[model samples]
Target: MTGRRRWSTDEILDTAAELLRTSDAESFSVRKLAAALGTDSSSLYRHFRNKTELLRAVADRILLAAMDGYRPQGDWKQRIAALALRLREAFGEQIELAVVWGRYGSGGTGSRLVMEELLQALRASGLPDDEVPVRYHRIVILLASLITSEAGINTVAPKEYEQGMEQFRVAVLGADPERFPALAHFARDIRPLGADRPAAFEDILAAHLAQIEAQLP
Candidate 1:
């Protein structure tokens, strides 16, 4: 009976990764994955204890892919930026996974390695051991929160995301000139929201790194 199983765990994970490309996290299920493999759900259970475990593995797979083939380079700040962006790009490649990243958090060895790398980068920045915890927490939160939130803008549902963006654009365009001076004044310039995200992310990340640099010994 056990000899009937032909799929390897890696194969399952690979197929699951592909499944993530087309399906949002909300709709992803072990049963769906099994269906994709043309097998019963029990086949997956033979390899993964439960959905949560499989999801955790999937998250680690993403983190591992981000870390693989990456080498630390440049100044400490630049190194941090490169690493963060690498992680972001990995999620960006699979927009649906990025959409659900917030829910699972999905701690793994790869995630730990990323944090360790951050701590090392902080050390390179000349930050003192005493300040490591607070500073590390700030960097982690800044990178994770901003990256995932940006991904979630497209959300789990296409119609919902579109509807939300339309309402947001309407508000931005409709705000009273007197009460919302800055937004009103810049509304026209902000017309290209989609095009500005990369620049916005860069500017924000630059400011954050500068703040950390000021604290260095």
Candidate 2:
């Protein structure tokens, strides 16, 4: 079986994901996939009973990648921020995947396991169980919002979005040399730098974590 062409669940999921990304997940059909893979559509039915099952498989594949290499380090807040960043990076890489991920209730094994670990860490840090729920919710919402934001991704091409942001900023803030001193002073800082992203999000999340920790007991 060393050189066999038999497809495993992992291979099928990966192929399905590639298909989803190339097109939309809702539009991807098992028949089409079967055609592309040179197999009968019935072969797919053996692994996945239906499209819903296949979608779940695809989700697991993405979540496994999202949760890969994630480990708690530093203080509880810092650890949560790390998890948040990893989730963001994973979702940001695939917009459709992100949409699907955000749609699921926070009860899947991957999400639950991560939540349990985070709650344990937070509890050990002297945070109450009730507070842990709220804190985790806030962190997830912040990360999801940040990752899905059009503004954040639009800021990707610095020279392009930065100039656009600058023009908009000036018009909205009414760039008065004397009145809006701080805005005038930090104009360049507001302008995006091609290199300032990805890592910049981490820094922002770090700051948010600190603010959250401050609110906790």
TM-score of model 1 (CA atoms): 0.83
Weakest ten-residue segment in model 1 by summed lDDT: 190-199
What's model 2's lDDT at 139?
A: 67
- Count of clashing residue pairs in every prediction: 0, 0
State the lDDT of candidate 2 residue by residue for 91-203, as single tens digits.
66666666555554334567666677667667766777778788777766766666656334542455876777676766545677688888777765665333456777778
Kindly report which residue stretches of model 2 are placed more than 4 angstroms away from their true locations once superposed.
1-6, 40-42, 49-52, 105-109, 150-200
Tell me the tens digit of each residue's lDDT in model 1 across 1-217.
Answer: 3555578998998998899887777778999999989899988999998877777778778888899887889988998899888888888776766655556766777777787888888888888887877888887777767677777664447787677678878988988999999999998677534445666777888899899888676
Top model by TM-score, which number?
Answer: 1
- Model 1 has an lDDT value of 0.79
Off by over 4 Å in 1: 1-3, 154-169, 178-182, 191-195
How does model 2 score by TM-score?
A: 0.66
Residue 57 lDDT in model 1?
75
For each candidate in turn, the TM-score is 0.83, 0.66
